[model samples]
Target: MTAEKEPHLSVARTATSPSAVQVVDLFCGVGGLTRGLEDSGINVVAGLDSDADCEYAYSVNNDARFVHANLLETSSDEIESMWSAGAVRVLVGCAPCQPYSKYSRGTSKEDPSAPVLRFAKYVDDLRPAVVSMENVPAVSRHPAFNGFLETLASAGYHISWETLPASGFGVPQTRKRLVLMASRLAPIALPASNVAKAKTVRQAIGRLVPISAGEANKVDPTHRASALSAVNLERIRNSRPGGTWRDWPDDLRAACHKGESGATFPAVYGRMEWDVPAPTVTTQFFGYGNGRFGHPVQDRAISLREGALLQTFPQDYKFEKAETLRSFALVGRHIGNAVPVALAKQIGNAINSHLEKYI
Candidate 1:
């Protein structure tokens, strides 16, 4: 593996022309990373994912085509064909992190390494001028990550990676991610946190008018909150910011919380503090019992639109249209799983700076 150097400012701050770059995002859930890359002036040609449902949001919000193919089933030629003849092919992805994420239990029987290894093999075959990946920090400890490292080094690419806190960049959540960048053109490294002060949850979603549980704002369908049962409603009423289930009257606490094992899971069923960054947006951020997702003042979990905002997705960024109904699980999954747009923009800017100097 290539020895990693400390991150430094890119050699040049100027961005190359957008036509000179072509990016293909693999396993793109709903185009979060691609949106940010486009905002940073990179041209994302298309996003490939196994979920056909992502077509609407990915294409509508990004103006990028969506390819419905399993990453494992895709070929190097298929992806390479999307590239412009003389442009810098920038390949990027965040493989599913279920195997390595501390937040999830197993969901699929497929080999966890299959996607990462396949992506690494693509980099080897195409030898794209630039490559980028983002995933839960735990992925760095997995053997698949090591294999990815070896593939890049053997391919003569200069590689660097770092554990970055999304809040430090611009996102208003405390999600930490493992980000890796590789380049055949130059030795590239991630930039330092450019924002002077971390943005808080209030700053991200405070302006939206409050809604009760089971209510959807008349103006924005995505601003709807999931309904809570009577008992769960009282439980949320009792909870405080960053508080655990222990505050609930014994009757309101779940049976799971009565045992000794409950001590280890204190981060759940709590409201977010308004002053600090919100807890990491998860796939179930709409559920009151899931993590510290409850709104600090509102007696309900954060809404889908709020979750997207906390992830730094633009306010006007569309997640659903006339054809797409409001489904929390579906839209929440897209918002939660998406890379924070601000963070991706930072990465894209760094790469553009590298290209300006080297190419």
Candidate 2:
């Protein structure tokens, strides 16, 4: 049966035989998870998301067909239609996680669990052979997660989860993520952490051509940093690796830093250490004042390309075409908000190994 109510997709994933497992990724922003899973030889067939702007990057970077639609509007029947007749099904997603992030704790006005609840419905309707999900560490604690557990239990799926750091999976940042896997085929588990092999800032972006504040690198598009004011330039000039605004001259300090609360958020206006993994990359990572985003020795903030590299994206990964107008705010959101490609690949590796056991 053809998809009538399904969100129209321009391209379809290559049809696979029933012996092969296919994946449909939900909330595929710029195709990070999809790309990583495909790299693991998992044959991700399609990805769906609400943002149409993601279409260009998502389609350009990955083989999966992009479906521009919200998960809330999607039905399980429509999802099942993407696969060949009687194909082994897998559902994977890293839902909108801002509401469950530690930074937005107690401040999320939206129902943070809406996506989780939606995901549960799809699992029940489709009853795929395997399921996978990743999100901020806090998601494991939310009430919605409990509801998700109940749904899986009712469906007779075995589950495993852990709050693992991104560095543990070779990402060049210390981002803690909650990864969960469930399967009706057999008990499954995420791969073991590899923290001892963690990549560092120097290892991730040390070889890229250096560009000053406001200057775009001639060789690469994402290698552009936001322009720094004269004051902020001097602020970074005086900043040391791992040092905060406290290292700046008192004359250059913001008013908020003079109060007793000065001790709070000491990481703000800080520079990253070259020898260590970066602090968690955030939505505002391109701005010098946003967390520890300043380059260790440079008198500028880390550039868009640097942030993406720190997130374990390939150096040539096309976020936007080089000719397009790439703003720091716009591109930064895509890089920082994505699942670090390295971490996603680790999850994919686990899924592949699990599938092989039953294959």
Candidate 3:
């Protein structure tokens, strides 16, 4: 089915009921999380992020005020003011998870800047009616992560958390993320996976307005890729669906592939499969050497548009203007990292059902 026909898909913000609960999105890179929340009838009053590139897209797409401030630096008073202005204060945070990701396997925690732990401080201070956090699955096992849950418990929240597979909720990718929900109203469970069969790359991107190398889609310009060099062009052509660099001829393989470290990173320099859900779309999705980012049938790495679409972004979602490459990257990264709209909506639906008693 075309993305347009997908019932769960929504992009641009719509007018919500005045009774709609207001949300404050923390670390709201480009508002992907807010978009999902807004679609579920939440009014996103504001979005906060450190990256300036996120400002335009977050503001324009979701029509929420964008605050370019580091979560660590922003004072509790500032957060409280923002929350008080909203109808029903919902604090959502997606702290940086790279330091705790399984991908950073050999890295030591002794590294000076560990920001994930700081999220607990924000939770302690704001004390919103509800708190939701999403992050890499590996983080759930961390001591700091456990401590954060403890902090929430101390604040009188009945919490529910689980590691969820994105594909289980109809996302066209195989990614696992930890989702946590805390509330005083009662114990809140996240939505169950809605998908019975996994969606594939073909199902996600096959019908989008197509564009050539270095060309932008006229209808929605952000759906384009930077042009490929001659060598890279040939490399992508030889890469088969779901196949890695091992399929390449000796002459075509990068020198790194012949080395020991390279052998361990087989998923890099790979192509996506048409029949299976894509590998987790990451910030570097526009780069062919990053994960299985290449199109299964097309001879180009997935475009920014395809990446966003695979993440269930609405076709009409406004990214940064055409000239802002950095903004596009920020928007793409946020969309890639976002909880799938379908998944978020399911969570909202679950919350709605749970709230029926009070309503």
Q: TM-scores of all models? A: 0.93, 0.94, 0.87
Top-lDDT structure, candidate number: 1
Q: Please provide the root mean square deviation of candidate 2 (C-alpha atoms, Å).
A: 3.4
> Between prediction 2 and prediction 3, which has the larger lDDT?
2
Clash pairs (backbone) in predicted model 3:
none
User: Total clashing residue pairs per candidate?
Assistant: 0, 0, 0
State each model's CA lDDT, in order.
0.86, 0.84, 0.73
TM match of model 1 to true structure = 0.93
Better of 1 and 3 by lDDT: 1
Candidate 3 residue-wise lDDT at 302: 84
User: RMSDs, each prediction?
Assistant: 7.4, 3.4, 5.9
Residue 33 of model 1 has an lDDT of: 91
lDDT of model 3, residue 185 = 76
lDDT of 3 by residue, 1-359 (tens): 11211111112333344334657788877667777777776657677777776666667677567777877777767776664333456788687776776544346655323456667787788787778888888887778887898899999998999999989987888888888888867888787887889888889888876676677777677878767788778888888887888988888888898999899888787888888898887777887777788877777788888888888877777666666554545665666666666666666666556555543
Q: Per-residue lDDT tens digits of candidate 2, residues 181-289?
A: 9999889988788667778999998999889999988888779989999999988998999988888889999998989897798898899999899999998999998
Q: Candidate 2 at 146: error in angstroms?
A: 0.8
